[model samples]
Target: MNAKKKDPIKSLGIYCHVPFCVKKCAYCDFCSFSGQNSQTIADYFKALQQEIRSFALARFNSDVGDLAFPVVDTIYFGGGTPSSVSPEYIQKTMAVINEVFTVSEAAEKTIEINPGTLSASKAESYKAAGFNRVSVGLQVWQDELLKMLGRVHQQSDFIQCMEILRSVGFNNISVDVMYGLPGQKLEDLTATLAELMAFSPTHLSCYSLILEAGTPMTNLVKAGRLVLPSEDLEREMHWTIDRFLKAHGYSHYEISSYCRPGYESRHNLKYWEMVPYLGFGLGASGFYNGVRSVNTSDLKEYGRLIAAGKSPAKYEPPMSEGELMSEWMFLGLRKLNGIDDADFKKQFNRSFFAIYQEAIDSLLKAELLVQDGSVLRLTPKGQDFENQVSLAFF
Candidate 1:
């Protein structure tokens, strides 16, 4: 077999999606289900394993024959509540990954868990399987709000889950919280943050509630049965949380993420830095060798393709250079430290100012952007209107 040369510049991140949930949230449009049969979940795992094996064999054989797979630096098990499934399944999947990929000794492995599904046994399994990070979806600390969001777990469940994780020796924990719900007040958000601070999680993902099309929450709002917080109020909520978290010693590294110093989400940082990653499972997406691809969302179709030794990719498009540059600025600006002009030049071999001078000048004039030394970052005003700033690059 002819060996395919390894690309020294390429670093790999792996994302495995688990699409089974005990109950789907009202506002969630992600590919996940409620009350799926055990047999279906089992079959999906089988198909997922097959897909993983097939992908490894094909990538290893294609032009890079017999070469070891790239060293994976990060592995993320994201969900429909990864903890909803049996821990044994997670163990088996990890074993398959270990067999095929050279996972780094210092790799950051994370799994997203819903408080309702986590148990001491599950936490032990995760620890034994080499998972170092656990991200719990606690969307809101208020029990009433949790019920309104159709979450299966209450505030007590969240606390217990945290206890179990800590008991099993998982130090790196992240909590997912949301603001700007239908009846959520600024005081509600403030109280939630206070409670979260008490827990002292390593990381926090604070997201503003978005009314996606066709979601139950949107439907209720459209029917005049629910009232979402006004845009101004939502903006206020964002700044409030930002101020609170920063004052408490959390770095607002990304627009919607805060972390204790040295605890930023490594896997998520890869996306913002435009590092290559492979995603597996139904409806998962990946960016590999400059091509972006998404897997089939239809479970039956995905299973059939894997069984036939065919790629499950529903879309795989090579990004144009202009598109890539646009992405570079958009994603980089998401970080508080923002884009380094030197790094941009190194990646694209083009002067950043030459390409974006007009946009930069206009934004700087509007006080929406600021440049310090070699770094250009979003101003406080710019962070508020991030969507507008991102569009300027496009």
Candidate 2:
């Protein structure tokens, strides 16, 4: 019999950040800009293309010496709002990426969209440009809440956007929702979920509101103009989402992510599983070759540096074995199915139980973690207190 053919190369994920939005949300702290003229937007994409071309495989091969070139298996266009710009920019950027990288034919390509920013023309353009997935930012169903969050789009915009996307033959859709917002009630969350479920989105990301320092929303809470939900109420909201989506045939595969079976975000899984990936654009973070890289947040600096043939990123020293193991445990535990001891041993050449026995014993005794043969997973209660459980492993 002929020997089984070996796979040619390992896979890598690509994240292209488009840091432009129509307007800034009150709660957002991501590295994004608004109110830019056409010139600025055009300049940014030019710089972005330069940044993409800068990572040509020849250059990467010289840096890594003998490291095998990775085939790009996933590409994610995330942003302040990727859809706010002209579809031609997206198309051209995709063209540049294809020129520089060895992207797989069946790669999962995704783009983030703001509801109001998308149109029928843009939706069809995205389909022609080869985007297989769309993640829409629809934090809540109530117009009042959207206004409070400084979101430009309302429920109607979301509905229209979904229709346009479907009309363009795009079916792999993910809707982002938020819970535990200031003045948000349990009933409000359920109502939002109910309205969104009508769209039958293949993936759903339910996030809790986190007050970032210096953001407008945080200032309101600090000044007593708004109040976040109490801890008990927030916990109830989390569980409510869990029960509601699971009943609707969505799998709660990761913390804050639910998907119809087999529809999990492949790009996101790369982060949790510690697979290699490259991040292009301002303030993007990437990990590969055991090193973590973060691009400069300053747009002008990023453009200038790339123009000068220098990287605008800060590279961290490669992670030690202990650090990698800790990250593996924490990130892996974010999944509902948790981590595998056998997989850990295979990666590190050490037994997971032997290393984390004390921490594991304490958590298991407290009923926060359960060991099912070689697999360890968070209990329902443990999921609620994920931070505390993670601290034990650290």
Candidate 3:
């Protein structure tokens, strides 16, 4: 008898990285820069379009005899700041994507914006270009904190941007805020949440500040010119915001993300669920068909590769089965609900407990994990040390 045939993967997510910003924040180490001429920006867009088309054509050619083309269920335009570019650039990219791929009728499209760069016309253009979700970066509420973080936008700018987005008929808006900043107080966070609640954004991503190595913020801390909040204070700030958001009708769906019912980020959830995605543009990464790939970070290199009709991917290594399982556990556990045992077994053809019984037993004994029937999740205490729990799988 012939062996059973496996099903082909479908329903991909597309991520486009727009590596431009009006100004680089002190804490940011992303591959984005400020102050480029219009010609440079225009050239980058041309290369980006060529790369998108080339990738699509290659994917289509590979799937020649397949029953159905892979459908794109989500598209995320992440930044530096996607809104930094002119709206026409966004429209042209969307046009290219639609020309090459089959975008699902109910696809979720999202774009990131910085309050300092968002304008009313741009907001309207985004809506017209089929961006149904908008995430605005409003790192903090206080002007002093904003300046300390080297953000160009003041508190007033964020409020005004929110107003513009609303007036332009954007219903699904997510606001990004941060905690654990230098000299941040509990009252400051509370006040920020209060003001944000007034806007009634559908989603909130409240992240704790991490002092990455070699960033300006880290240098200042090392030089004793800046002092971050104490660990206790940071923890307090995290839980305080979580509880407050829950009380205000936002579900803490993920460790750092809270959303109203049905407003969770579809594209980001794909990452946690191990769904395949295609990534375009400088420094973007993608995981598809058992392979993980990253585009080159250098603009000149990326442009050169695309111009030569070559793949701009700097790396494309297929993941081993063990690596895939480890990633599944690590990403799945990041969700507030944790990993589903049944789903794990279905995906890997192995029982979760059978593979990680010792690790599970140890965590259970340590009161870090709790098993409730088919689901395994982090305890409230475990959530505080999630890194430790995730490391167990490794």
CA lDDT, every prediction? 0.89, 0.90, 0.89
Give the Cα-based TM-score of candidate 3 against the true structure: 0.96
lDDT: the better of candidates 2 and 3: 2
Pairs of colliding residues, candidate 1: 4-64, 4-65
Compared with the true structure, model 2 gives a TM-score of 0.96
Instruction: Quote the positional error of residue 232 for candidate 2 in Å.
Output: 0.7
- State TM-scores per candidate: 0.96, 0.96, 0.96
In angstroms, the error of model 3 at 242 is 1.0
Task: Give lDDT for model 1.
Answer: 0.89
Task: Give stretches of model 2 more than 4 Å off.
Answer: 1-8, 61-67
Q: Per-residue alpha-carbon lDDT of model 1 for 1-394, expressed as tens digits?
A: 2223354234689999999999879999999987888998998999888777778778775665435457789999998888999999998888788777767889999999999999999999999999999999999989999998989999999999999999899999999999999999999999999998877999999999888899898899899888999999999999999889989999999999999999999999989999989899989999887888999989889888888889898655689999899999989999999998899999999977889999988888988889897789999999889988999998
Clash totals for all candidate models: 2, 0, 0
lDDT, model 3, position 355: 85
Model 2: worst 10 consecutive residues (lDDT sum): 1-10
